[model samples]
Target: MHSFVYLASQSPRRSQLLEQIGIAHRLLVAQDHDPEPQDPEALEQVLPRESATDYVQRVTGLKLDAAIARLQRRGLEQAPILCSDTTVSLGRHILGKPESQEQAREMLQALSGKTHRVLTAVALQSGRKRLTSLSVSSVEFAVMDSAQIDAYVASGEPMGKAGAYGVQGRAAAYIARISGSYSGIMGLPVFETANVLRAAGFAI
Candidate 1:
């Protein structure tokens, strides 16, 4: 068991969650100079007829593979490498990060007074072995008028988050209820994350 592992994600929230659980991890994010720097965003493009579960798992595995290769390229010492991916789904439709303010508004409006699924997949690579886990949670939203949607969009909090809103932010005001892991909706599910880490032989 190692004292710390490599976390290959750009989300600050993931780092904070790991710290919250007393897991020491080193950030192993992709750099602009990386050989496949564009792979991060490219991997997220939804495939034709891809279910949310498959998409999240596939993307998480891809990220782990990339990170494993990256670690070897850098000649870094061997330790478990972790990666995660999250997506919002309304039925089979995957709601990705909004490209514009209007799109953000549309996503929020569509989610009003409805239920959606938030799926987060975590993958861990230890030596030549790999492990993965998934967390699925349902969220119910209160009715939001046009004004509410517009104001939330204007806050600029929906731009980079899946489902056009962050669960830990102002959007929580409109969430009437949630039926799964709150940490998963925030980007990384600490429970599933800890499972993979322990499976990879981490002391945590």
Candidate 2:
């Protein structure tokens, strides 16, 4: 079994999720590389339109590929690598992290009193083998007023999270109910993540 897996995401939520399951991991942040969302034109070009699941999976694969290249360059090919991406979906539309306070407020208003799906994709790569898994969770938000949205936006928690909200943070008060893995909605699905790691020959 591998001693530890290389996590290529910078989200503390992912790291906490891994630790929650007792999975030993080391951060493998892509130095000097900025992770950007797919261009609007490119995203619109996907045939038949990509579902939230497809979007997250594609992004996760791209990050894993990048991490693998980085590892190879660093001469650390022996360790398995893990990468994940999360996105919020309202029907066919994908909602990524907000770029500004206004965007966050808009996202929150759009989600007010509605049910949205959160999709998280995890990828594990070890030597010549690779595995991927996805977790989907539905979250229902209560009707949120502008005051609440403003306060949350000012907190700065929504800036780096999908759907411009964090279920485990202050936004929890706005969430009326959740019907899936909480950890998954947070960014990393613990159940699927553990399975991928074990399948990739990493001992949890």
> Over the stretch 1-204, how does candidate 1's per-residue lDDT look in tens digits?
788989999899999998988898999977877767545668788889889999999989888888887898889888888889989999778998898999999999899999999999998888878888999999999999999999999999998899999999999999999999999999889998888888877777
TM-score of each: 0.96, 0.90
Which lDDT tens digits does candidate 2 get at residues 79-165? 888988888998777898888899999999999999999999899988888899999999999999999889889999899888999
lDDT of 2 at 13: 83
- Point to the candidate with the largest lDDT: 1
TM-score of 2: 0.90
lDDT of each: 0.90, 0.84
Candidate 1 Cα misplacement greater than 4 A, ranges: 35-38
Off by over 4 Å in 2: 33-48
178 Cα displacement, candidate 1 (Å): 0.2
Whole-model lDDT, model 2: 0.84
